[model samples]
Target: MSNDLIQVLQNLGRPQVLVLGDLILDRYIWGDAERVSQEAPVILLQADRSETRLGGAANVAQLLRGLEAGVSLAGVTGDDLDGRELRSELEALDVNCDAVLVDDTRPTTVKERFIGRAQHRHPHQMLRVDREQRTALDAQRSETLLQTVLPLIEKHQVVLISDYAKGVCTPEIVQQIITHARQVGVPVIVDPRPGEDYSLYHGATAVTPNRLETTRATGINVQSSDDAFAAGRQLCEELDLKNAFVTLDSDGIAVVQANGDAELLPTRRREVYDITGAGDMVLATIGVAMADGVSLADTARLANIAGGLEVEQIGVVPITRDQMLGDLLTGPRKTYQKVCDLDELAQHVSARRQLKQKIVLTNGCFDLLHVGHVHYLQQAADEGDCLIVAVNSDASIRRLDKAPDRPLFPQQERATMLAALDAVDYVLVFDEETPHALLDRLRPDLLVKGGTYRRDEIVGWELVESYGGDVKPLSVIPGVSTTQIVERLRGQTILKRPAVSQAHAPERKAG
Candidate 1:
């Protein structure tokens, strides 16, 4: 039984994860806090930009998607603009929103935050306002949610409930989903509401409540890991949960199992930018790991890493596959703050273009980190304001006529290593033999490659040149490469062997 996280990550295929709870639309209004307002003591803000992202259960679904998991989100939303936008975004990601209901009584929940960005300091939340109907779900709506969730529970590998006390996650709905999931043997994980009765969430496989939440729910004043462990064990016992974890903000995650076993896993230190959806990140990570049959202790560790990465960003940012892999392999990699998929890359570059910044792109099989790779990346970074490196997947290396044992490092590790470098603003994996698909999507301001290949022979050079994008070929460091290192090792192994007769092996002496 190997406990290797990379092997687990490899085996944790795209399991269908069903996320049910309150769906919310989070809007961020970003601007500069230029001066003090005359009318009041509030700061004067020149709002320049605003954006909306999935929130609550929707945020969980998005986070699962970022971790490269198959997700389906179920909840209630009004037939309003925010509802429509939320559904459209989920559908665009191929998330199954079929079970989501359009209700008439409530407006779609929208949490709007006005944030102020200063020149030297980090962005701060100026104000937040929410619009929603907080009334309990009507019996008819409860029945609708139960019917929608029951059939899908068995279809998915695991079920996650993200309850924010919104009308959608009533007791009836939660119980029905839990009962059905128990019947089907699919584990149910719940992110419960603070100060509420955990009785409704009984029989869950696991419950993740934060420090303050544990204090409120169980009356446990948690100041240390020991207190958190006590709270977790008590909550698990009262609710009949198989496992319970209390998220201690900076200290770490303390988890307790029903068997009376407990452990506190400290989180990786990172810059706490904004903790908007950190719990969502933890819940989603647990859902993914649990569905793959990982141990609870390992699951908590991975969730801790995910939450740490979550707080390193300014908004409700999703922790990407590479970012987590980077955290697992090379500690914390801050450059992941800019890494994203092609669609997001397009949006990111367009915004950067609005800010009049140049975009540079380069693709390679950066296996086995060395000085050469770093310098090459640095040279590519010099070509533009933002550098995007596309890493070739291991399978892609095989298709490139390389040796069967090529790519000394896995694709995720390679991307993670690249993301740790200061020169790299973003890293994406391209599985094809060439990066033409990524090129077609990005159409970057500059295309860069190693000088080993002819200028005309470079892949995507013609397209880049045609679009007025410059193609740069940087000189690689001499006599240093992954192939050279591998070959040298192979030769050393052969030379170290005892000499044998060239014609044939001598007969063994009888003992």
Candidate 2:
């Protein structure tokens, strides 16, 4: 399952996606709340920073762009500064906004949130103020929007409707979009607004509704997967959708197909900092996968993962393809799972590098794990986002000839011990003397070693530095050498295994 998901993520080809719905500008005022306000009983917030981000359908389009999809956003915005700024931001991300319509009568939809942090902690939302016009668009403007966007649907492989119930998604426009998209063999996915009547999104390829919205639409009061499936089934049947993806917050996504097949696609539980744009991410992920003709189950799974990743962040940060691949490559935090072969390790490193995460690598025999090794590994982990601890193979250790009898622990046991450390992100055993081959393949951003040796004397230092990689030397604990421990054990009447002769030795290596 991991490999399959990784493959899907690796092969996410760029597809043209059309995004149509309400466009919003999200404004955040950031500050520290240090005292109470004298003017009122509310907490006093001294604003220090402010930012504006694309929201609603614009957020979906930006998310698609982050996933390497070509995106065209079609939506309505007021002919004001906020609208212009929103379009500029979209254009900066290479999103095509030629279809964005401007109306002079209304103000741009803006959601302003004030965030306050206390005692240098994570910021929390103090309050939210919304500026929007919920009144439905007039008939002439609605027709103009339809005429402008309907013709462009055929140019795209997938159409996404992100409805915030902000007047852009009228009944006529939504229905026409789905119908026209269907006629041209293009799929339409809707992130429907919370409303009693979902008929506006009828005949769409799929609908992604959160639990509360699903309950409101289906009247099922979804509290579990069973209820979610029932609610999703109702949406698919009543709205003529091919599938309904109901997102049940931490419970993951429940997918129900028109053919009565249903499954709950579970997600890894994340420390949810904020759920601002999780729904938009899910819709974007599914749209991109659907554009490439991925299966419904796989699409839902990818979307589920995307949503989980989005909530782990503080705001509407887009989930990139590399981030998804990295999450899949590094699954559960199992000690055994951290140990990988050279080829698998290369794949994991590639994913991390794509996500712009630094890779710190160190190589040693690690025959006898001790506090010194743990200390070094912990320091190495601080050098980058992930630490790759390379251990020498048993044969390599034997060829090194540290003593007549060396490497008391086998290579597998040594690697397992290293993997069990929280500081070690990945463990691999190399047969070669030095990790020149591994370093050349992985090209880690930082090469770390624990010893008194200078950076130039470290193994693979020159090779690593040749490619703009850094080399760092750490302090080792005094009198903590494995040879010293082995000698102490020998003095205590410990039995030693027979050493293999050098006759069949592949080559000499050192730790």
Candidate 3:
């Protein structure tokens, strides 16, 4: 099932994604909690450093970009320094900033969280101060945002309405985006606000509401999947939503389709942390997956995994495609999380280039796990600090006429397994038969190829060398191949095969 879902991700094209809603800046102040003050009873904070990241709807754009989807963000930010800084941050991630408007009346929504650590241990959030407004965007500014966002809806395959209820997602603005998006036959996914009035988001393709918000919006006591489903159904019915989803905190997520079909994704077991942006991650994943034509249930599972990954982090961390796949195998790593879109790849490359890090890229159809793949991956890892392994999806493998019943495991599973290894820093799945386009996008410092291929014979070698990137070729395993494994398994009795450790040969190397 995981493999099947991963196949959907592999087949996902770089569809344009538009995010419309409030823009916020999240600030984290880290410090040490020492002795109390001499005059008053206040704990002294020995400040260390502070950092800022995108919040609210802007965060949805960041996650989409990390997932390799083309993203355009439309929202309103105050004309203060924070607002300008927020725009800079979005432009840094290569998000289209033209639609991000500015108003001088209100301040940019800033959620400043103070985290304190004592006695050199793990730090915890102590306090939070929000500096912003919750009132509706002024009439003129609202009209301006509508004018800016209406045209953007027709240009995108998917639209996300991230309602922080910070005034940007007014009824007028919501109606304009949703109405135009529907006219263009695009899916409009809404991350609804927490209130009884859901009419503001009416006509959206799907609505994602947490347990609390779902209960408030539908006036239902959501204690179980059945109750959540009831609430979701009510919301879907009221808002004419095609997909009704209720996110249950520890239990899981429940979805009620327009046809009344309901399914609950059981909570993937994990340690919970600050669920700051889990809902945002869920909404983004489902929106993009829905646009990509994935099944409703699989997209729910994908969203569930993304939410789980987000809570494990301290704050709003963008959920990337690689991180999403990596979480399916195990968990997420800081550096290996994002799989950049072509537009955003330049930004990541520029950042990496500034850091002077070595990049090694390799491509393969890693259908099933084997020792040879791991050994080659490790060899590839040795060539650079960051190793990017691009796997071919089941469809892509079939398109290449690689083998019958190829990719026993789905593309997601292959990418996840490879990313679970310590040697691999990132994994990308390409549906294209030839990775020449992907190579052109990345143009890594080193290109690694396995299975006895000469540097000159390898795909994209010339392109890599064009940018002074070298190509490294390695040997294949003595007697290891997916076909031999399948043949050996078929050759032996089904029950007997499980008892045997080696499928193809008497000896097998550890993967």
Candidate 4:
């Protein structure tokens, strides 16, 4: 993917994402398990902190907003404390909750989890208490939700249905939404509830079902990759879905298309902390990427990476664009290092240069690294004896990024990561908008970029050329970029929904 494509994906700034389904609140209670209770055999807990987050369809909207997409949520939230909390969380994430109807008949879906922590072991969940109504939404409420969301759907490229089996994703509502979305040429992606008849999602562009859900819905045993592929194909054909993506926990994903072509994506290795809200992350990311014009195969690859990142953290954590980009940059390169300071990094670079290395230097805020960036960096590294990467300081990154929450990774850490690579010999940290002054100081033997423009396109290209340094063009990596990575990581997987198959099943590892 060219840097321009990455830029296009990042600058997609607010492509409205329509969310229709059950809205809920996720409440987490963090505490320490110290002793057994005197009256019961339960472990006594010392509470530390409590947090409330958007859940269900509300979470889908939040995930879209996290990817910098304009999000509008249309769902039913009860007139209760949990409902209010859900609204508050959505507003905080900048998601439009105006269409969120306040239903009085049902209690808002609230999943409360109690987490116990000790010194060195993994945190364990004591209990998950759920409050919800599984009955269908009333006619009045269903009409109200449709009236509020249909117009908004016309203006967006993608629609997401998040069903928690909480009655809000009624057959009438889902069918109406999907029919309308298709009429307007908008694609609808659904995270389906298991055991619910697939008829509700009759015309959806795609459906994301976890292994267990796919098994239950299709009555196919998903104990192996072959079973998953057969089950996915059956579900797709039976439901008339454009695609069926079956998420196999740890083993990765199997995608089955309407045409019978299946593709299996292997899971990335990770030390999982909590699996909460991983599906939401995948849904939001795939939706955004497809909306932004990413291909299906590329979208699935990005989603896999995003899902991996989310599972590494606890609870419902939003994966930032910068973090996703960083992953893309590091994914193709295996060399890693830990450097404490700039002096140390520079010394490392000098040592590499001393070995007659042609040092290729390039600098950027790299606030959100994408495929364009990885391709550029890798190509740049290929041109020199040793690639010297210079990153803008936090202040510079903020100046270039504008957003306060940007550059998820600080300069020092970013530099350390870049320096640890075998392709990179040194990393320089600078506080300037342009790397002109730094280039003058470093006087690298070569400078490179991924764009089609001549050396003049780089801000410091002239300086390097004037200093008798070589300026070169590096071929852009197709279909791999930072922006796409961000969208994919944020849970959008529709356009590039993976093809499911047992023949191409993912390799399994022993735990």
lDDT of 2 by residue, 1-511 (tens): 5656766788778999999999999999999988888899999988999998889999999999999999999988999999999999999999999889999989999999999999657899899999999988999899888889999999999999999999999989998988899999999999999878888888999999999999898889999999998888888889888999999889888999998899998887888999999999999999999899888888888998888899988779999887888778665768888898988888777777777889999988887888878888899999889999989988888778765566788999999999999889899999988889999999999998775567776888889999999998888787565655665777842225323222112212363
Off by over 4 Å in 2: 1-7, 31-40, 79-85, 117-122, 295-298, 312-315, 319-332, 355-358, 382-385, 394-407, 431-436, 445-475, 492-511
The model with the greater TM-score, 3 or 4, is 4
Q: What is candidate 1's lDDT per residue for 1-511, written digit by digit as tens?
A: 1125544554566679999999999999999998899999889889999999999999999999988889988999998999999999889888899889999779999999999978735789989999989888899888877877788888899999999988777887888889889999999999998675889999999999998888999988999988998898898889999999889988888989999899988876778988899999999999999898888777888888889989988889989756665555434346554456676667656555655678899887876778877888899888878888888878877777666777778988888888888888888887877777888888898887753655665678888888788877778776665555566677754244433221011101000
C-alpha TM-scores of all predictions: 0.66, 0.84, 0.67, 0.67
lDDT of 2 at 93: 98
Over all chains combined, what TM-score does candidate 3 have? Answer: 0.67
Error of 2 at 332 (Å): 6.4
Q: Write the per-residue lDDT of candidate 4 for residues 1-511, one digit (tens) a residue.
A: 3222334334544567888888878888888888889999998778888988877888778777778888888888888887887888888888888788898888999899999987524678888999888898888888888788888888888999998888888888889888988898999999998784788899899998998888788888898888888987887788888887788878887878898888887766888898888999889888887787776665666677678888998888888665665554344433344322455544444444444556787766554555576667877877765677777788776666443665678877777667655566556777777777767766788877654344555567778889788877667565554434544776976356433221011100000
lDDT of 3 by residue, 80-146 (tens): 8999999999999999988998888889999999888887557778889999899998888888888
Runs with alpha carbons beyond 4 Å of true place in candidate 4: 1-14, 332-511
Residue 183 C-alpha lDDT in model 3: 86
Model 1 CA deviation exceeding 4 Å by range: 1-3, 332-511
Candidate 4 Cα deviation (angstroms), residue 387 = 5.9
Better of 2 and 3 by lDDT: 2
For TM-score, the strongest prediction is: 2
Q: In every candidate, how many clashes are there?
A: 0, 0, 0, 31
